[model samples]
Target: MDPEKVFHMTGGVGVTSYARNSSLQKKASDMVRHITTDTIQELFIKTTPKSIGVADLGCSSGPNTLTIIKDIVEAVEGSSHKILHPPPEFRVYLNDLPTNDFNSIFKALPEFYRELRQEKSGGSCIPSIFIGGYAGSFYGRLFPNNCLHFVYSSYSLHWLSRVPPALYDEKGGSINKGHVYISESSPPQVSQAYYKQFQEDFTLFLRSRSEELIVGGRMVLIFLGRRGPDHVDRGNCFFWELLSQSFAELIAKGEVEEEKLDSYDVHFYAPSKNEIEDEVRKEGSFGLDRLEMFQIESNNEDQKDDHAGKIISYGAEVARTVRAIQESMICHHFGEGILDHLFEHYGRLVDEEMGIEKIEPITFVIVLRKL
Candidate 1:
């Protein structure tokens, strides 16, 4: 698989754009701070007198990544201050795919270091950034054993390049199908295959983390997830279904090529909380330190007086980003007009749904630690 081709489909632009958005960054930073203060601090209660190393895996380039790193640094600094001996040096590693926007991340590092220098009050050592080169999946060992004190990953995992071939073809050959995600309501085989892949990938992730983390090292993972008891494919995402329907409508009207629409794929998997916990248990090494699940209320309480205008503006941004992603061919097949039509259709669908007072709810945080 070519890195450029893969990233072009569902990689850089969408993730980078999302990460740069102020609201998302703030939310992620706040969540990281809470996790560090509540769980990580407890784990490091005894591992003093030595410097600590922290890592942010799948850390895409942008202010969002920086925001999370800053929060962790601040928390560590606070923890170190209470100790009798002077605090040890802090090493922070930022790891992402080889095709990731590392240039942006490196460019921002000097500013981060400058800020840390200014913030240091006493004999505190400045935090250092080590750019890590971990190509391919983040589900394997990337660091030395027992080296990391804390590991954090957000909005990254839950993506597998392609569904397992075994699920699609029992003989283990390529099926050349459009996307198994579309077979959501169809056969059990399709869903099972995707689930199996997720299981394998997640298991590898745990095993690798187990080797890298110290006995008491901490990890916090946050991502876009769903809240439901029953497993529904909804095409790997409800949002994707809405966009696809929009595209289908345009194809019917001869506005776009069906071939163009059929050639691409969206790589996202939103697991239920139960499914996630089960995977964690299977890993067997890490113990669940803290897990909190909540529905993020999409409706703005302050916009009660200006509901109509606010909804339109909000829907537009969502549509814009979605369209930008589709237009960029990050998924391989979608063309320029397809994204526009998809966004328009999505906006209309959202408007109709809003009329019924339905607000889409996304899930919240989970934090764990090595036992």
Candidate 2:
């Protein structure tokens, strides 16, 4: 299946929408706000572009995209006070796949602009900020050359441009059977295929951004990553493993076809810090300003509270979080009928895993400067 066509978060302001389930992402972004604002401030002070062009790739629907823009403008405004140069105007671009729910973000802009206007000074707005949406993939060019000054992406980049070509053999059939991602039982070739895809896609991303960003441009990228070199480590792949285990149980009961299970493969990869560094160096268009990996609890703190009798509810919430992001693709591969049952089994597996040990996902905060 073409992921661009089939892949998108569960849209709209429903119970399963990404906007409701994205607290984890918000927490992760909040943890790095200091780093993000600091980078923007420093870049602004140095380059002093008359109009700062900021692109937030993979910015899904709702007011979150506007929140990013607001923070960036605040950061630049803060730095303008320290220098003699006048504050730069803002050109904010929000981008996501065409299938994403762009309307929600658009509907929320009036409120955002009103809030920005309220922060007025001398009967004028703080900065002349313009917001527009660009719908497409980020693995290729999205803007004109030398137009962007700062770029930011959060919780994206792990998705491949396409499924790894090596996943299929000469006959064009899946090799990693009964599993959607690389698991501990997967052969060495399986890991190699995933890594090869990440290498090519990430290189292409850097090249594309290099052309768009001016010299001395800075970008902040935050995404899921693994702490170790092992592909089977419990960073993010383990969640897929739990789903695979659920599929296996369904296959045994004849509720889902084994062939259908084998036919599906997740178009995602989590690379290590060394692997990321290697690709950045090899790409040679950008220099790493800061590369650090941090961990956050997989489940919410409230979910963890009152855990004595809340295992099932806790697991259900976790399943719902993953469901918000992946239900579209899962429903496309398997029939929609399987979602309730499939996630039920998946939730049980999550509860069991959580009972066994704590699950904290490793995330990478990478700051890159155009050379």
Candidate 3:
């Protein structure tokens, strides 16, 4: 299946929209803001080009999207002042799949521009900041050669472009049963298929970016990653297991067919640090500067006080986040009717788990410089 056509976060500012349920992502961005700011500042001080090109790939729409742009621009603006150089004109590109909600982002541009003038440019540098949308996969080329000086992506590289073909047998039957992703029940071959796909996709990504970024350009990547070399580490993969248990409950209730569940698989993987380094070493494009593992507070919620409602609200918040992220793919494979039931069950499972022990989601912050 074509990932461009099948994958997208749920759009619009509704109860289930990514725009509304993305606080988890907001927290994630906050966790890595220092790294982002440091990288941008370092790049600006080093290259103060007349027109420095910046691109944010897989930049789904929401306040977080523009907020990141604002932060980067501010970082550059601060650096220019320190170095006593005139502020460089900004040529910013926001990239995502074609089916992403660029319309909402475009409509929100007026306010974004207004704020930029008031806060960033001091009402003078608005025109210097030119923003445009480029819709395509980052697994392929999306910009001109030697054009971009800075590239950033957050919480997106974990998604493979497509399910690995080796996941199926020669007769097109699923090898993984009763689970959407690699789990304890998954065979060792299941993890192998996923690792192979990630290797290919990440190598292609590095090769493509190597041609676009000029020598000494800087890039920051943030995505889900495991702490150890184990492919089936439960520390960061319990949510997926919970999701599979949700489907099992549905099958038990006769709400979903067993055959349908077997055919569906998540096109996502959380690679270990060793695996990521290996792929980058093989690609031979960028130099890895810094790699850090950041863990999110599982109980990051409004009602942190000890109350029954706390767990319920926290579970609901997590379920909402997952629905906003995976709704498109889940609806495509399992139909939209099962979302309410499936997620309700998933939330309960999460609550039970959270009560026992908070399951922190692990993410990696990787800083790269073009060779």
Candidate 4:
């Protein structure tokens, strides 16, 4: 399945929409806001352009959409004011797949613009910030050569261009078998396939950014990653394993076919810090400035209440978050009939198994400067 065509956050303001379930992503974005501000300040200090170009790649439409732009503009204004320099006009690009809900972002623009005006009246030097939506994959070029001063991607870049090519054995049998992602039990070829795909896609990502970013331009990338080079890190692999166990439960009831579960895998992989650094080095376009990993709760806290049971609440939150991002792709692969049943089973598995399963998810925040 084509990820561009099939993959998108569940659209609109429904309960499962990314709009509702993206607090985790917003938190991840918050973790890197300082890096973004510091880098933008450095860029302005070194080479102040009349018009600053900034892009948020994989900017899925939701409450999270346009947030980084607000932060960027605020940072630019604050930096310029501190140095007694006039802030430049801002040209911001919000980019994602063609199938993304750009209209939601466009509809919210008026409020965003009004808020900026209000902030300006509150003593900020408001440069003209013009926002536009660019719909495309970040795996390829999206902006003009040397056009962007700062580029930010949060909670993206882990998605491969496609499912790993080696998912099927030479005999055309599914190699990954019951599991949906790489696990300790997966064959060596499965891990090799995932790593090879990550290497290729990350290299292309850096190369594309290198061509678009001017010399010394900056980027901050934040995404799910492993603590070490191990391909089967529990944090990276076990969440999916839990989901697979859910599928197995459904399979036992004959709610979903075993072959369907066996053959399907999400087109996503979380890399290790070393794996990311290696790809960046091989791409030869950007130099790493900062790389750090930080932990986040597997589920959002707002979903919890004194009334709700802990296990159910945790499972439900995780199910909602996963459903928001992966539902469309899963629907595409397995047909839409099974989504409710699938997530229900998935949630049950989480409630039953998660306490014992050592799943401590950590994310990587990387700041890189163009050569």
Candidate 5:
């Protein structure tokens, strides 16, 4: 699948944008501030230097990116008392896939800069921005070695490009085609191939970032994920599967064609805590400073008396988004007529499944330092 096209459709302006607003950023900022300040103060007895450089890898456009940067500034400021000299200037780099909506990010920057300038103290400080693309992957040689002071990436990097095509080659006779990620019912070999690809991608990421950070520099990653006993099922991105199923149903009903669905695959990985730690260790780059996992409180729960009702309502909304993409061919499949019935079916299924009250838990704020 084309990374640029997928991001434009999903990450450009949709639920992804909503996820990266100022409010979410503020929360992430506070978390990073607390962790970094404590780690720096306790670990490095010496004073910190002025003019710190920070990077937000995979920082898609909007308040979320700015929020993380702001929090880093605050954390540095708050720790000034511990340092003998005045605080340093901040240079922040925002990075993403080439196809990310950089215009939106740029548009939001002036206001973000203004707010920071207004809040500044007497100390001289400069804030700078750099934009670039992480073309192949996030895990290697993106920046000069040992150049950065801090790094953060949120709600991104969980996705990988589609599996290589060779894995799906069919033999002379057997029905075992060399396909990749056909469906949840996809062959175990295909699933394993995708999993191996993610592992390699993540390992490279750790190693690359390890080389980029100064010995004491910090990095944090906050992203959408899941947890379960089984590693294979842990990052259960069922929403995409459901969407695919919906699309298949539409195709069977003559609402769309198989050709349109040809180019896309929902790519995400949800690794267990153990899985993440193991991968990091294997990479041998950074030492894990911290790890924490928590669930974002869903608004549906607070508004409804019946927990089951709330679950159903939330599920229906999720399904609605999926169906909207189908109706509009957002992923380049199906058409508009299927949207109404799509919602109807989704709503019915969710309402019936309310007894399960399923919720997606976001995972892992990992702070790593180059060893």
Candidate 6:
């Protein structure tokens, strides 16, 4: 399947929209704000280019999309002050697949600019921040040579450029039978297929960026990852496992065909720290600076005192987050008919699992310096 054509975060302002259900992503993005700030500061301390080029890859449309650019611009402004140099003109690019909802982001830009101007009126030295939307995959070159000083991606890159070919059998059956992603039950070959694809995609990503970024440019990547070298890390595997069970229910009710189960596999993988380091070493264009892992509760929100010893509505919050991430792909592949039922069942399965075992998702924040 073409991820560019099928993949996108849930759009619009509805409850299921990524705009509404992206607090987990917000928290994840905030976690790396310091790293992001320091990297941009280092850029100014080194290059002090007349025009600062920044790109946010996989910048899906939502409140979460422009917020990153805003923070980066703020970082640039603050960093320039410390370096005692006037901040350069900001040339910011927001990138995602061609099918992403750039219009929604464009529609929201007026308010973003207005707020930015209002906030800068006090003492904030506002550089000329020019924002543009670039529609394409980050796995390939998206900017001119040596044009971007810094790059940021959040909650993306776990998606492969495309589904692994090995997942398809000779008869066109998906080798990954009952699961959508890497799981303990997945066949050994299925696991290998995911690892190979991740390595290739990440290598290409680094190669492409190497050409676009100047020497000493920095990139901060935040995404789902495993703690160890295991391909079938259980950190977030249960989420997909329970999601698969939701489809199983539809199959039993005859609302969805069992054959579809054998043909569908999520084009996502959370690589381990070792896997990332190996890929970076092989690519040889960037030096791995810092690799840190953080564990966050399924829901980023604070738990209420009354919710002690209970799941604390984390299941619903998690279901909403997953829905925002996968709704478009699911609708494209499985048809819109099954969405409501599927998500309802998926939420129940998540709640059931929480009652049995609490799952904490692990996020890896990686910083790389251009060589």
lDDT of candidate 6 over 19-108, digit per residue (tens) = 877888898888778888887887787888889889899999888878888888887778778778887898989999888888889999
- Tens digits of per-residue lDDT, candidate 2, 251-363, equal 88888999898889999999999999999999999999999888875653334422236433567777877888889998888878888888889878887888787666789
Top TM-score: which candidate number? Answer: 3
Best by lDDT: 3
RMSD of each: 4.5, 2.7, 2.5, 2.5, 5.4, 3.1
For model 5, how does the per-residue alpha-carbon lDDT over 118-193 read when each residue is reduced to its tens digit? Answer: 7765554644444333443465567877667777777566666444343445642212132113344566665565
Query: Which lDDT tens digits does candidate 1 get at residues 77-162?
Result: 57767664455566677887666667766777789878878887575566554544355457677888888888888767666545
Instruction: State how far residue 256 of model 4 sits from its true place (Å).
Output: 0.9
What is the C-alpha lDDT profile of model 3 across 1-371, one tens digit per residue? Answer: 67789799888888788988788888898999999999989988888888889999999988888899888888888888888898888889999999899988898889998887677455445537788999999999999999999999988999998998898999888999899888987889999999999999999999999999999998999999888877676565778989999999999999999999998998898999899899988898999999999888776344632223343367778888899999999888889999999999988888888878887779998999999
Compare candidates 1 and 5 on lDDT and give the better one.
1
Question: lDDT (CA) for every model shown?
Answer: 0.62, 0.87, 0.88, 0.84, 0.58, 0.84
Report the alpha-carbon TM-score of model 2 versus the true structure.
0.94
Error of 4 at 248 (Å): 1.1
lDDT of 3 at 25: 84
* Ranking, lDDT, top scorer first: 3, 2, 4, 6, 1, 5
Q: Model 2 segments beyond 4 Å from truth?
A: 121-124, 298-312
Model 1, position 19, has a per-residue lDDT of 36
TM-score of each: 0.81, 0.94, 0.95, 0.94, 0.76, 0.94
Off-target runs (Cα >4 Å) in candidate 5 are 4-6, 9-33, 36-47, 82-84, 121-137, 164-167, 170-184, 229-235, 258-264, 299-313, 316-352
- Candidate 5's displacement at residue 216, Å, is 1.9
State the TM-score for model 3.
Answer: 0.95
